[model samples]
Target: MIEILSPARIERARDAGRLVGTILRTLARRTQVGTNLLEIDAWARRMIEDAGAQSCYVDYAPAFGRGPFGHWICTAVNDAVLHGKPHDLRLSSGDLLTLDLAVSLRGVAADAAISLIVGEARDAQDERMIATTEQALAAGIATAGPGARVGDLSHAIGTVLAGAGYPINLEFGGHGIGSSMHQDPHIANTGRPGRGYRLRPGMMLALEPWVMADTDQLVTDPDGWTLRSATGARAAHSEQTILITEDGAEILTLPNP
Candidate 1:
């Protein structure tokens, strides 16, 4: 399931990537204290429909999750990290929130995620958690390019998280993405260099670096989808969809003006 985009297909990918980036930015702006999680999902639904794009998560039913995600975006808050299913909770000041989104436009899909504090209060620990993930993501992207190994990207990501004193979780990480949301060549957050799949031009990869404050263990919420830290410590995650090119890796999902 490793998809390599043709020249024309790359254009469609960019379109989808832009849509994802714009939608995320819009959602981030709208989020604040007292905003309900469900409200955010509804907003995402409207924006995706207006753009004539499809949500990769709305109808998603994977083995690890309950049937049909039935949500437009993943609203992970505080201790919650991955596969966060939006619920009735209202955001409060100082809440660390992560929004992960993916959409298909013109048959190509792009995925990305961002973590930030909800309001004016920026806890030092929360800021460190978010910064570490962002730094790890940047490092991963910097190591990506034609002929580079997946391990190289993983090592780059691991160095940042480890240096920041955060435990790395391998249960979920980045992966190949294209026509469908998740694809082959699983990219772990930490690994040895010069190992795993080799990079090639026209290939697309979603490089995500996520970490929990205290432990690497995760617990599934009662909803059967949201993954939270076992120790209930704050967490953060960062992601972007990148396209492998002959020259280097091109980040497709960046916020639009």
Candidate 2:
């Protein structure tokens, strides 16, 4: 369902967004070589509880994902991208990691994701892929505003990723997020401008741009939740929950500088 949040509800959403941002930043800092994916999930649960917030993934059940996600955070490493279910794996140096989180506070929800390299080692290609996704995310947010078409944001994001020579996947993308982790108004990573749903003040949407290094095809892992590149190519994903406003869009989930 499409929801246009009320002013007071927007304030609640801001709080949710803050919690999501802070948790993601903390997780990124704590993650490193030798870190266990399960430990990361445990950390997320503690943080959410301490803040008196709720984790959207703990009980997430959808047709696409295994029922009751049973994890506090998504820990995607290297080839893994979206819906990465936390598992028993210790990260290694230079591993490209993506952490996607969604939390609900005071009944409003916010979602965001970040991609980073674990440990001291970094590959040039991995760095470039992550940077491109971040750039695409920024471009998409810049296109959101009252009266703007969803396609405008998609086009803006697609331009950045496609220009970087990465293939775009439409199987899963961003979506409206508020009160729940996923909602209506599906936002594709690539689309024609001046098409799709029209934006209005008080609307909140999550714009995520993800890409595979060499292909657009995805293969689901045996876990039934984690999605990986078909060619085992490294992947990167970036996202933010934005609040549509009269003049522009307010990015609710930006990590501290």
lDDT of 1 by residue, 81-161 (tens): 999999999999999999999999999999999999988756798887888899999999999999999999999999999
Candidate 1 Cα misplacement greater than 4 A, ranges: none
Tens-digit lDDT string for candidate 2 (1-257): 99999999999998888889989999999998999999999999999999999999998999998678899999898999999999999999999999999999999999999999998657799999999999999999989999999999999999999999999999899999888889989999999999999999999999999999999999999889999999999999998999999899999987545
Whole-model Cα lDDT of every candidate shown, in order? 0.94, 0.93
**Which regions in candidate 2 have their CA more than 4 angstroms from the true location?**
255-257
lDDT of 2: 0.93
Residue 78 in model 2: lDDT: 92
